[model samples]
Target chain A: MMDSPPGVADLLGVLAYAELTAFLRFAEDATRHAPSLTDRAALGGLAAAEYAHFQLLRDRISSLGVDPEEAMTPFAGPLDEWHAQTAPGDWLETLMKAYVGTGIALDFYREAATRVDDETRDLVEEVLADEGRSQFAVERVSVAIKEDPRQSGRLALWARRLVGEALSQGQHVALARPELATLLVPAGDDITRMFARLTEAHGRRMAALGLPSRP
Target chain B: MMDSPPGVADLLGVLAYAELTAFLRFAEDATRHAPSLTDRAALGGLAAAEYAHFQLLRDRISSLGVDPEEAMTPFAGPLDEWHAQTAPGDWLETLMKAYVGTGIALDFYREAATRVDDETRDLVEEVLADEGRSQFAVERVSVAIKEDPRQSGRLALWARRLVGEALSQGQHVALARPELATLLVPAGDDITRMFARLTEAHGRRMAALGLPSRP
Candidate 1:
């Protein structure tokens, strides 16, 4: 296959694991009743969609000719704790996780996708289309919060934590994949600007989602 | 608007509630990490996906002109208890829940889709596509188990509990949604056959996984 920088594989591995875990969790946890059968069905259906997207990532990894299992073996622990440590405090908080985390991850992946060749880039685009609903899911939660002013402040805080925890674990991910980040460096410049751009973009996402921009 | 027979809404409500609760619990519990950053990301991603699916269902309900909040209110309890009673012992057991329980739910949803209206039928079909990577995750753990014969029996027993707990919850769903079950009666058939078919399907799934078919 095509070649990229040293840690691009690690980035892909992390992305692949994210999709897999999300697929499993969505299938397992989305069982409770809603007011309507249609609502219930929709919930279950969306959960299933995530699973398919996850499979795409898995396929992408194996197609790259590296064993996904080996790539996924190393980064599993810290990522999991960040999630547990920042588990949603309630239903609304859960929605915020999707609204905030998936949205942010999508942004990051879009940037990472630009650094790769046609094959990997296409995989990234395919996932982007697949995640269309994820963005809508986030938007819907924002609408709900908008409808009820009481919900705004609470969800904002939740969104902030989602950002903070993400950035924290993200530090670990960066340290682990320095070469992946190196792909972002200009021909003669240092890597500082790459992260600065990522942070600036994250700030835009927060603003778009109606949260305050990070200092 | 098309209407479900008496109590069908309640049954659907319970199922929806269960979905929501399952989303919450799995999201919370799966994040319990054991030092692997890869594991952490995998688990977190899974939780985020579940939350997204939960939003889909919630939005679908609102689209139907029903308030999702009101619809989801009824299913928060008994379903919660069922999950509590059936909680997995560890990561492997958790994966088994994905394999055994979700595998069966997908089957039931597939069969049930035939009885619903076209829109609902399409939704079910869409959801079925999402079961994509779950089997692979489960398969990964299964491969690990067979590598060590001693691990087999533990997983085997775990499989039994997963199936058992599911059967118990499935009954609650069936009893609660007698309308849907009645709708499945072929307009003149014995209901027992329907239950038998469900059980039989569950049996095949278990056997396929090398987990003993339920007694």
Candidate 2:
């Protein structure tokens, strides 16, 4: 009978707060950038999904006999820093955050989930399931780039900055919680290789959005 | 058939946008004001409910064969103005907006619901139905005011300002779209009397919050 890993709670807490902040930032960005009521409504729907994921994570934290707030507090600084440093400036930038920023975060979480217990891994997978609005970002960004080819240079650069800030802050968060970091790699895996895999997936995502990779 | 009042779609559109903007404003206010993670998560849950209501109204507008954006365009200016003019300065003020401001808006909508077709009325009623978090606002506001009795003075003033701005913008919106105004009163109903009833309910709400009535 092995002791349960401390990483489970840390992972859930970080994920909970991420979903909560994502709800806030996405709703705010949609308010500022949605071009029409239809688009605004769509973004609002996505924000709702984030809130639901937040609740699921928070509830899991509580069921583990820990206060949800205490669990989530450790990662707050790093996540807030990432958002502040990568704050989007316009509609296209907002979509990039929604697509590229959130897309990568989900990618990393999915990768980490594989190293945790089955229950937590199932919860992470449920949260990561597509909410169906990612295509809205894809279509909107692609169309905007098509309309103004010059946007390609600016947006590609923006995506590059997002990746850098995200990875850097992600490292800070991982170091601040070693249990969580340990879960970033399974028993036999290397952390560097895990990061390389994340970066490669990010490049494929940028290519799919018709943007230049890695600056 | 009395030509099935043109105001139905207009009413749904306006409500849709209100819910959408409320979702954004509430999420932003939560980020700014919630004192703890639990409170923050609770407010985020409320914002999610608002977004869900927005979707319901938007879908109803679409089912009416109207473009949701075109239908919502007319009232955007007035609603945005009301929010900008009355932005909350702290957690208590935010709760006031959530409790008092939202209470007034729901009252007005419920009153207007009676004047529309049954289908639209039902949709309005459903959107207006309690999301169960209003009690959170009530308890938090009451506790704060109890701790610092002077807060009642400021909160009462804030609530009054919210009502004034809301009614002024409500009039502007009604004047801008006569069809919607027509829905404020069914045949043989008096608009003045309806407004008086709304004002009375607001007074009662203030009293419930332990604040002075109507300045």
Best by lDDT: 2
Error of 1 at A133 (Å): 3.3
lDDT of 2 by residue, A177-210 (tens): 8888786777777677777787888899899977
Across A1-215, the per-residue lDDT of candidate 1 in tens digits comes to 35756665677778876765555444433443233334434444555565566567667777778777677665666566666776655556655666566676687778778777677788788878766666655676677768886877777667767777777777777677777656645467655565566667766766776766543
RMSD (Å) of each candidate, 1 decimal: 6.0, 2.0
Q: Can you tell me the CAPRI class of model 1?
A: incorrect
Clashes of each: 40, 0
Q: Which stretches in model 1 have alpha-carbon errors above 4 Å?
A: A21-51, A130-161, B1-81, B91-181, B184-215
Candidate 2 docks at the CAPRI level of: high
